[model samples]
Target: MNRSRKIVLFIAISIDGYIARPDGDISWLDDVQGEGDNGYSEFIQSVDTVVMGKKTYDDVLKLTNNQYPYEGKTSYIFTRKETSTNLNLVFTNENPAAFAEKLKSEEGSDIWLVGGADLLDSFMKEKLVDEYIITTAPIILGDGIPLFKANNPEIKLNQKSTRQYGEFVQYHYVHA
Candidate 1:
């Protein structure tokens, strides 16, 4: 297993526990504005490395038109297929936990897994994640990707804090 000590999975979901729409689109989130001191932007700024799944990466690329926001940060893309890009992107040659541990060994900054269902499922199954910061929007999408798929193990989280910003409610959870 990769020996990363500091790892976090951060995301925003609908009240119904959907991270993205059935079509893998987050356009609904655009209108919400998800404002206030969710501390996510600040938290992401503190991290040095970000890990993501291939599908998640593709969706982000499509959404952003390939213009990634996190510049100068080391990002590890986990995929079985070989990918090529003109921009500076690191391909993780190791598994999620192992890759995270390697980053820690290199004195890497905090690691955040910004992802799709599969990668999150992998990390959760491995029990390598330390914290979860989830923002729940006021609206609900009945059908979409569940926060954790049925294949995922049961996780017990100790709620660290909850903040309300208008219609948005942010929750901080850590393994119990």
Candidate 2:
């Protein structure tokens, strides 16, 4: 039995399997943000914390009127460079799995691995990801930041469940 606090990954991808445009443009996602007829809103509220890459943070900041959804939840940001602004925010320059283990040791809630591809790739490479919940939108970007970058390692997933919401399809995949 695994006693570790699970790290959950929640993302919205296109039907063609892309997270954002090649330039990190996620204008399409905004249209269907939290529009899932399913329990996605509940899913987001259930999490205790969220971890994201530096670029993802920047992108999200631009999209969300500078208000981070995980403001109440413990938020962790992974970045090699230092930011003088995120003083109160948990920031780390360490490996994903190692940092995750540390977070698991401390008293807290569930962890969310939010991404911009690079960070997701690192976690996938370390095999630290426990559960994946993806919302697949209807339209294709045709070009933009992919859900997984080219540098990511190959992985296999076991489908947990699927739900249709508006023009989006949600896919829940767990470790195979």
Candidate 3:
């Protein structure tokens, strides 16, 4: 078996494949009737690092009342702006696939792609995502940021497992 660190896309998306509303609002995912943490606590334990777009990083801070939730993990925030990089956050505009390839070769556990639409688009273009653990929320905003953009690179994945968390259905898929 190929034994190297993996980049996993672990996220909760809407039933219509929207990750957020057009305004980057994810408040709809705030309260879903789900089992204890909905496997989040367990999943977070498996990664030592996180990769996300600047907007995503900012969103986390807002949602957590300015407290960075990924405290102990190194966070790579992709950005073009010259934002203040402090503590465990590493802001960079490195090419996504190159950065991901380099990170995966290093000795570490899996990495979490805590996303916004753009970052996912970058990774998807190069097929850098190794696994997708998507939990689908029931509500749809009708018009929003879709999970995949039009003309995105096509990929094939094999369903590894399916899980139920109250009204949410989580699907685990590995690149095929």
Candidate 4:
């Protein structure tokens, strides 16, 4: 039987494990020692679909000129509030775990779990994530939104690789 598509969590966090500030500010990520791609270009190329929380989607919109960045890939925003859909973007109120299971069963390139803490918690709770690619910037936010908010029971992961670029360290892990 063909296996389900991999669900990968690709995100950056501060050294203290915060993905953003209290008000959802990620300005701290702007300081990187080296220039050029930082492997993101290659990483994104492997993703055919993206699943994100409403807050994350809104945050991304703020970065663009009010334009959707993942124009060519399938994008789904998990939201409870009414939201309008545009090309390549769909807002769904479906159960996250159910939706994720259906998506993974489909034939496609890996799915990218672009996140907010809530969405991450839901997916992790369902044990839907297949791999995690986290890049840590060498700065700590004394207090902020953590990478994982829920009191998740331990999940085992096998380290696949580790790479360092200037002050950033990227860890690649697969569910074990």
Candidate 5:
């Protein structure tokens, strides 16, 4: 199948390249100042689906009043542990790369690879990611969850755009 849909990794990381604290605390992000949603509203509007690691899903659930954050988007949680299904959330044990390839073949606006390190590793290993939209916050976590965890082959990226929102800098890159 032709994989026309772009798989975009949209995430926030510390200046030192950590997504969260070792204990999964992202409270540091609360201090970032911006006009509004810091471009997230526009980015989410272009996304029709979201793929995230189980840990990320769990963390989000804990942070958001026990509700799913991505309301209208079809959400897939990559996990080996069994989980009950919800209306918009699907828990799957399938290989991340294969599942992502299949998803990309379907007609959709774009797939948001909202993450945890391991899922990013899997996709990187299979070369499934097409673009990356990373926002770097000013604070640096000395040691924490690295943005790309798994040891995978190096991939090249071409910088497309960049924007600054207060103390944060957002970078857009396309696979090259």
Candidate 6:
């Protein structure tokens, strides 16, 4: 019997647990001194689908100056506003967790849950997230958009592994 594809939350967070600034600025991430691509290139290759909130979609576009990363992969953007699909991106107003459940059942590689806070919370609430690959940078934002907002279900994680890339620490965990 085959299991559903995994929904992995692979992200970097500040020491204070913020993923980005209030204005969606993630420039601080560029300062981290890490060896190689900090496992990003390898991680990206392991998944063929990306699930992200609208804000994260916008931020990636803005941050890349409209270059649009995640080139060879399919991306689903959860939003209330109307948006157009281009290339590998599909904009949808579908319920995140509901849609994700269907996607997980489909034949594919693992799915990457690229988050902003709200989307992560929804997946957390529904217990859809199967694994988490969090890379904690050495710097603290003090205040910003947190990685996990309040009211997320308390999940017990099995510590899979931990690796250090310079001052950055990468943690691998799976739901227990």
In the range 31-134, model 2's lDDT, one tens digit per residue, is 76454345666787767778899888888888889987566777788889873436347767887778877878776556888886888888888888889998
For residue 70, what is the lDDT in candidate 3? 91
Per-residue accuracy of model 4 over 1-176 as CA lDDT, tens digit each: 68678999999999889999999999888876744666788889999999999999989999887888888999999998976677788899888788987898798899999998899998888788899999999898999999987678699999999988777888999978
Across 3-22, the per-residue lDDT of candidate 3 in tens digits comes to 79999999999989999899
Q: Scored by CA lDDT, what does every candidate get?
A: 0.79, 0.78, 0.90, 0.88, 0.89, 0.90
Candidate No. with top lDDT = 6
- What is residue 114's positional error in candidate 2, in angstroms? 0.9
Off by over 4 Å in 2: 1-3, 30-38, 83-88, 151-154
Measured against the true structure, the TM-scores of the candidates, in listed sequence, are 0.87, 0.86, 0.94, 0.94, 0.94, 0.95
- RMSD (Cα, Å) for all candidates, in order, is 3.2, 2.7, 1.7, 1.5, 1.9, 1.4
Q: Give candidate 2's TM-score.
A: 0.86
In angstroms, the error of model 2 at 3 is 4.8
lDDT of 6 by residue, 104-169 (tens): 889989999999799899889888899999999999789999999898878999999999988789
**Lowest summed-lDDT stretch of 10 residues in model 2?**
32-41
- Count clashes in each candidate, considering only residues at least 3 apart in sequence or on different chains: 4, 4, 0, 0, 0, 0
